[model samples]
Target chain A: MKTRAVILYGLLFLSVFLVLPWIGPESIDPGKIIQFLSGNNTPDGSIFWLQRLPRVILGLLAGGALAVVGAAFQVLFRNPLVEPFTLGVSGGAALGAFIAISIPKLLLTWGPFSTLQVLAVLGASLSLTLIYRLAHRQGGVSIYTLLLAGVTISIMCGGGILLLTYLSSPNALVVFQRWMMGGIDVVGFHELSALFPILLPGIGILFLHANDLNHIALGEEMALGHGVDVKIVQRDVFIGGGLATAAVVSLVGPIGFVGLIVPHAVRRLSGYDQRLVLIGSFFLGGASLAVCDALARTVLAPTELPVGIITALIGGPLFIYLLISRIGK
Target chain B: MNKPIIELRDIYYCYPDSEWELSLSGLAIMPGEVVGIIGPNGSGKSTLLRIAAGVLSPIKGDVYLAGSDLKQMDRRTIARYMGYLPQELISVYDYTVEDIVRMGRYPYIKGFGAFKEPDQRAVIRSLERTDLTEFKHRRLSSLSGGEKKRVFLASVLAQEPDILLLDEPTSALDIHRQVYFFRLLRELASDGLGIGVVTHDLNMASLFSDRLILLLEGKCFRSGTPGEVLDSSVLKKVYGDGLLLNKHPESHRPAVLPRIGPEKSS
Candidate 1:
């Protein structure tokens, strides 16, 4: 069953990337795109390979990572409504990036040791840790407290980012604004390489504990009786989920509903096996983001909208529909 | 037939602001014994079970499993020999019946890894035992209330513990399912597993249990066979109202039928 799902998803992914670029306009001609992919390229083909391909790949990776993280958080916290944005990791990452861009000199002085991605990851980790610690009451953390804490911290972090944006130089402000508005153009192999180490380990750990996570969803006492180290599982899930969310934010800005929508869609298809959910979430998320990115690039031709705008535009109505349907059920 | 599998020594637990600590000075549960713990709400029946299951560490005293102190043993090691089902049923994911049942093999599996062949067989066997084989692929949310209870019971059964502890396992079930489940528990106890069930149904407890422990105000009000513990005076002491106690016609087990309000009684 798993093998079949993987194969089907792989074909879907291939067709999306391979077919969509060909159907576009002269600037992104299908033949040139193919030639560029095959390593025999014109200037236009080179542009597509270097610029468009990286953006697409990054969107796929970031989307998959974010969706898995959101799914993990929902399970770990035992709340169906939890998502990357709700957990404050995105806001924390934006603050980190805002700080990094505003103080480029301060960052540069660290001797090639500074990057927006690293800062974003650090900020996300710290904020998430703080939220976890604060939300914990007695021996356990309540989902309600965690959600409230996440929202509170996110608001605070957003305020800080706004302050930083206002105080920054116009050039820095322009860069930060574009990044915050959710540009896919900045992603490249270098950023992807930076993202791989943290994202891969975090995701691997989550998948490893998928069974325990399933037990946890039953409740803490039952999970412990089943021999789960509840505290360790909780810590690992928070850190891993936070890191994965941060990785995506660092790359593509906070591309909204992929994490929220993909997991919900996958859950409807995959039942409740966390292993299948995790894997299926990766594919669904990647496909969703790829479709969104394709639309973002092509919908207006010469003038492309921010990928975040596209996701929100598409995601809002879908989210509302899901909300109403869930309530009805 | 065998040494006691669980022994509680001077166990005392107090909720944060409670005036008095719930105390069980000494309690011993032998292998294959079906013990029913009965009390009103807030009488500490569930609390005692939680202490026995190691979900809550008693403020004072020790719990011994197989004569070894539970505090000394790791939680996972203790879990291997004990299964606990809490009062509430909250399944976070929409896991299938089989997947939920397989969770019982969690302790045996290493480091949250994939299930082994033995785990798979145990899960299948448990599903069969619970009569949930046909519903194995169905999502939990799709199951009826009775079905969900059975699935949860199946999950605990899959744990294959030598000792089973349940808190109000049948409180949410209909009368028919409750009777069916109590019969099932009796069968399991006959198979040499020590079972401790906390419940409010004195009749069912008397019918199925080999011994009964009546808790009132954080202490054992009475402990004996159902015939001795289910008397009118004890019922009056535990619950305010005096009730008539008699043997059921078919089962010849003690059953209590409390009087209703004054108008109905008159």
Candidate 2:
């Protein structure tokens, strides 16, 4: 089962990376892709090179980041239901986007980031800092406290978002709603390059601690006894996962279920080893999101649905099926 | 005397916002010996065991591991020569028996790599020693209580440490399995590993341990040979004459029996 799932996910990941960018609303000529690679300035070449490819790459990176972080956090927190969004990253980002939309005077751009993205990241960082401070104790941060603090902050952010929506004009409300329904619509490599700095190290830290996370799943004291510096692992995973979630949520506006469901689906396919779990979640997650993005782009042709909606439409039923089947087993 | 594999001297410990405090003047476990820590509920048996294992640090005094200050050593370095089994093993993920045991090699793993040949052999040997070879592929959630405990024992065994510290390892096992477990510890001790166990069963402690330390209210009341420590006079003071000490029928080791009150006809 493990071998088959690995192959299946590997194939899916590679095929999605190659295939999804070719299937957008306006199909690019196969010859144009080669022409784009050779630096031609044709209209078709620009569409394929500058537009579709970047969106596809963003799907891969953002999806991979969320799932990998989700897997790491689940082990670190010792809870199966935890995901990237559980730590208030999504709530904070949404609130930030809402603020940007409600007040157009704040709609300024900096280098690669729009005002909304910048504020979203700032909002996520704020929530992360608050949760960290709340959970910190004399010796180390308490996992129980961290979970509770995150949930409380998420609720507070939700409330803030609600108030902003109530006060905003209908024009701002439409834009906020669109952002809330997450989409990955990058036109070039600028946003992708901007994400790399925060995203790389964040994901890298989680991947590096895969073994420590495995020992942690046994229990905290057990992990400590087995030579894992549980305190360091906890701190790194929390901050690392938080930063990565913030970056991805800022860019894509908090796509749903890819973080929550992909790792679980990977665990079902593979076993509980975090080494396998993290890697499998990355590939399978990347593939799942890229496929969803393709559906979002073409399902209504000119009228695109949010990729987040497509993910929920597909992922919700898939998650339910997994749950029922697990019970049946 | 042989140098103690692990020793704790003048240790003081307490949890924050709690009145309970433990102050142990001195304790040591020498190689090829089993030291049973027998104490009533909340008498600091588990805490002492954890201190010896280097999992818990005392606020005052020194812990020596193989003649070195334990506080100065990193966890991986400490774990290389010592194995600890926590009392309650709550596995968050449903890992297989082999998966759990393989984790015992965590201290030895050099980098971000797969378990090597030696680690695999150690895991297999541990599973075989604990009689868990057939159950290696089974998930922990599917196992019986006794089976689960043995699985963790196997994990600790896979570490191949010179000293082992266990907290209430047999509290959940049946009588027959408890005896089997103790005998296994005895065999491990005979092979030159020092073993420290915290247990509630006095009779089993008497039979298995070379030395017994009886604790009362955060202090060591007695520490000596099991026959010397399990005296009726010594027990009466702590247990209030509610317990009787007698001889094991075959081994002649001191065994404890509870004294019954006056019978009522109903």
Candidate 3:
């Protein structure tokens, strides 16, 4: 069953990978796409390669990162309701983006990062550091303390975002509101190249601990008995999942529900093994977000809805159906 | 005549900011013997087992595994030789019985791809020994309390440890299954595993155990052969007068029975 689920999710991801690049407000012929791949310049080819492909790739990376982090956090915290943003990463990133929008003077680019993206990364780092310090103890970070600290910091960041919203000009408020809704509107691969360094290591650290996470979900005592170094696993899962989440949120402006629902959807379809769950979540989450992004682009034809809105709109109802169907089964 | 496989000497433990403390002068589990830790509520049986398993470090003194200091060894090293079954098992995911049991090989696994043939054989043997082969694919949530306990038992068995520390291992099992489980422990002990069990079933402990450590109020009340430890005078000091003693029909080991009547006015 789990193997079949893996294959099914892989097919979904591959189909999205192949199909979504051809799906946009402007229809591009397959021959033209192949022409673009072979180095011919045409209007359709340019749109397919430069506009649609980057967005789809960004969606896959960001969605996979968020979902994997969410799965890791749920196991680490031993709470099914946990998401990637539960630990204040999104709150901090949103606040940072809000700062960039409200204060025009701060909107300067540095290296590969725009000032908005840089500030969002900084904001996420600040919260991650603060939460770690608050939760750290003599032996290690206490999971309960870490959870409480993350929540407190998240709420504080939310208040800061509200204050920034209240103080902003109407135009800035509108931009900030749109940023808060989240999107993947990259024109090229420059941003993705910068993201690979952070996202790869963060997600790699999580993947290495998949078996440990499996033992951990049973309970700390059981994990300990199974020869898992509970303290080290706790610390690594926190920092790794935090970094992955911060990287994705900093770029995408806090896309919701992909992280929250994909792991659960995977666990329901696949078995509860972390190895399979993590892999299934990555593929299924990437596919789900890619499909959503495609819909966001072509749903109204030319005036794109934020992919974040589409994800929440589509993901929430889809997850409910999955749950209801399982119950009915 | 064999040196003790696990020894706890002059150990002391207490939870932080709590008045209750557990202090022990000495305890040991010899090779090829089943040592039962029988105690009243709050008598620290679980704590002792945790200390022996190296899950809980002693506040003071030493725990020795095959004469090496326990504090210096990491959990993985200890787990290679010692298997511990916690009293409570709760899972957030609907893991299959086989999945849970397979984790017992974690200590032996290195740079994972898949379990080797030896690990697979151990899992199969554990499931078969526990009569759970048919239920290998069943979700843990679908099992009864006794069945869940057996699944954990199978997991611990899959570890293939030299020493086993179990807390209330048969608490949820039926009468027949409990006896069968104790018989299995005896077989394991006779095959040279050092077994320590904390159980409330004094009669079963008396019948099955080679030695018994009776505890009262976080202290060892008695430690000896079942006939020596389960004497009415030795037990009355801890249990008061709400008990009766009988002899096992076959083994002639001392057995405990609860006195059934109206409660006496204090």
Candidate 4:
């Protein structure tokens, strides 16, 4: 069954890769799309390779990261509603980027510190660490406390960012606005390099504990009876899950809906085995984001809608459907 | 034949910093004893069982397993010898019956853990013993309350522990399932496993238990065989008046019958 899910994911990826270049704004001809892949250079092929390829790859990576983080957070909190953004990690990153943009004097004096992406990563990491510490009692983090803390911190950070935006110079405000509306076009090799090491290990840690996470859903007392160290599992899950969310936010701002929607969809298709759910989430997440990114690029033609907007448009209805179905059940 | 498996010495426990305390000055449970602990609510029945199972550390005194202090043993190591089935059986995941039962092997399997052939066999045997083999693949959420209780019992049985500590094992079962479950526990005890159960049903405990420990006001009021502890005087002291204790005509065991209050006497 797991093999079948993987194969299906692979086929989906291949199909999307094949369809994206031809259906985009410039509409690289089918022949050129094929030729570009075969390493043949035509003028039409260069446009496909240069512009669409990076954006598609960025979408796939960001979507997969968000889905995996969402699944991890759901298991960590033992709540189906938990997602990457719910825990203040995304808000912290947004605030960090907002700060970096609003203060040019600070940026000039510390050139390396001026990168919005770096500031976002640092801000998310710090906020998540604080949340973990504050919510933990006797080596365990309660879902209720974690949720409350996350909401409080997120509101505070979000409000701070708004204040900073109001005080910023007009040019800085424009940059901040663009950054807030997350997109896939800005990912460079350097950002990917910095993110790859952290994201890869973080996802690996989650996969390794897939079985343990499944046991945790049985409630903490049962998990402990099964010899699982509940406190240790809780701490490690938060840190690893937080890092994955922070890494993705560092690259594409905060892509919504992929995390919130993908894992729930995968669970409906696959049984509630964390091993299957975790892997399935990655594939479906990547596909969902790729499809959304393609629509974002094509719907407005050259205008390129924000990826966040496309996801929200699709994800909001899906979320409502889930809520209604769950209540019915 | 073997050293007493578990011993408690001068143990004292209280909810943190509270003046009220639950104490067991000295207690020892030997192998193959079916001990039933009965008490009113808040009489420390659950607290004593938790301490014995090593789930809660006593405020003062020592717990020993095989001559070593419980505190000195790793949590997993102690868990290997003790199987605990808490009162609530709420599960987070919708695991299949087999998957839930297989968790019992967790303490036995080593690092890079995979359920081995022995573990599989144990899970199968547990399911069979609990009469749940037919429902092995069913999700826990779909099981009836009695069936769910058996599944949880099967999980503990899969652990293959020397000592089984259960808190209210039959509290919520229908009368038929309660009798069946107590019979199962007696059978397990006969197979040489020590069993300690906390229950409110004194009649059921009297029928099944080899020994009964009656507790009141946070102390053991009487400890003896069921015949010695289930008398009218003990019942009147532990519980209030207006309860009658009589010998069942067929089984010849003690039975409890509720009577009207003295004020209702016309």
Candidate that scores best on DockQ: 2
**How would you encode candidate 1's per-residue C-alpha lDDT over A48-143 as one tens digit per residue?**
776667767777777788788878888887777778778788888889888889997645423323478778877887789889888886656766
Q: By DockQ thresholds, what CAPRI class is model 1? A: medium
Clashing pairs in 4: A217-B92, A217-B93, A218-B92
Candidate closer to the true structure by DockQ (higher is better), 3 or 4: 3
Task: Identify the runs in model 3 with alpha carbons over 4 angstroms from their true place.
Answer: A1-5, A29-41, A136-142, A326-329, B261-266
Report the C-alpha displacement of residue A291, candidate 1, in angstroms: 2.9
Model 1, B56-138: lDDT tens digits are 88999999998899988876788788888888878876778887888888778775456788888889888988889999999
Better of 1 and 2 by lDDT: 2
Clashes (candidate 2): 0
- Measured on C-alpha atoms, candidate 2 has an lDDT of 0.88
**Candidate 2 wrong stretches, greater than 4 Å:** A1-8, B262-266
Against the hidden reference, what TM-scores do the models get?
A: 0.90, 0.96, 0.94, 0.90
Which pairs of residues collide in model 2? none
Top lDDT prediction, candidate number: 2
Docking class of 4: acceptable
Please identify model 4 stretches exceeding 4 Å from their true place. Answer: A10-23, A27-51, A106-114, A327-329, B17-20, B65-69, B72-76, B108-114, B248-253, B262-266
Worst-scoring 10-residue span by lDDT in model 1 chain A: A105-114
Reference contacts recovered by each candidate, as fractions?
A: 0.80, 0.72, 0.62, 0.38
Stronger candidate by lDDT (2 vs 4): 2
